[model samples]
Target: MQLQKKTRSGSFNILGISIKLSIVILIFFGVVFLLNKVDFPSPKKTIEKIIPNENFKIVK
Candidate 1:
């Protein structure tokens, strides 16, 4: 029946949404974990290393 089809489709939509949400959450946590494990230089340190000159600059 038409009602049965509608209910099944609604459940499928919910399942799809939940799966996508879980995947996004997992990716976010994985990124956070990897960043925590790695040691990166501070923004100031990186800025200090750059030599500002005409070659790297966009305008003359």
Candidate 2:
């Protein structure tokens, strides 16, 4: 009876790990797909358009 319980616990642990790993992998691939679909411009262009001058700087 003790041995059976240990084996069941081990199987549950493996099943849990596999499920978590699959979820993480799915999310990673989804992010990659979304990034590829979107059009991202150069950093310089984005900065220039968003902040045209130095007046928007914050002083610490």
Candidate 3:
């Protein structure tokens, strides 16, 4: 008796795409968070400079 080969299908593609998208989203958010945290003049300071109204003060 001969063994039959298993065929691959679209499920693999869907899983691969989902995982890749998740990783890209995670990395993007991580970079954004890091940028907000690392002050070369920080996110808060930049926002304050851009909109220097008393109402727009950093709420933190």
Measured with C-alpha atoms, the lDDT of residue 7 in candidate 3 is 90
- In the range 1-60, model 1's lDDT, one tens digit per residue, is 355434344345778789999999999999999999999877665344666575575666
TM-score of every model versus the real structure: 0.47, 0.48, 0.47
lDDT of 1: 0.79
User: How much lDDT does each candidate structure score?
Assistant: 0.79, 0.79, 0.81
Which residues of candidate 2, in runs, are more than 4 Å off?
A: 1-12, 42-60
lDDT tens per residue, model 3, 5-33: 87975456778789999999999999999
Q: What is the C-alpha RMSD of each candidate to the true structure, in Å?
A: 7.7, 8.2, 11.8
Question: What C-alpha lDDT does candidate 2 achieve relative to the native structure?
Answer: 0.79
Q: Choose 2 or 3, whichever is better by TM-score.
A: 2
Error of 1 at 2 (Å): 22
> Which pairs of residues collide in candidate 1?
none
**How many clashes (backbone N, Cα, C below 3 Å) per candidate?**
0, 0, 0
Once model 2 is optimally superposed onto the true structure by TM-score, how far is the C-alpha of residue 19 displaced, in angstroms?
0.1
- Which portions of model 1 show Cα errors greater than 4 Å? 1-12, 41-60
What digit string (tens of lDDT, one per residue) describes model 2 on residues 1-60? 355434344335778789999999999999999999999876665443465686678879
Those runs of model 3 whose alpha carbons end farther than 4 Å from true positions after fitting are 1-12, 42-60
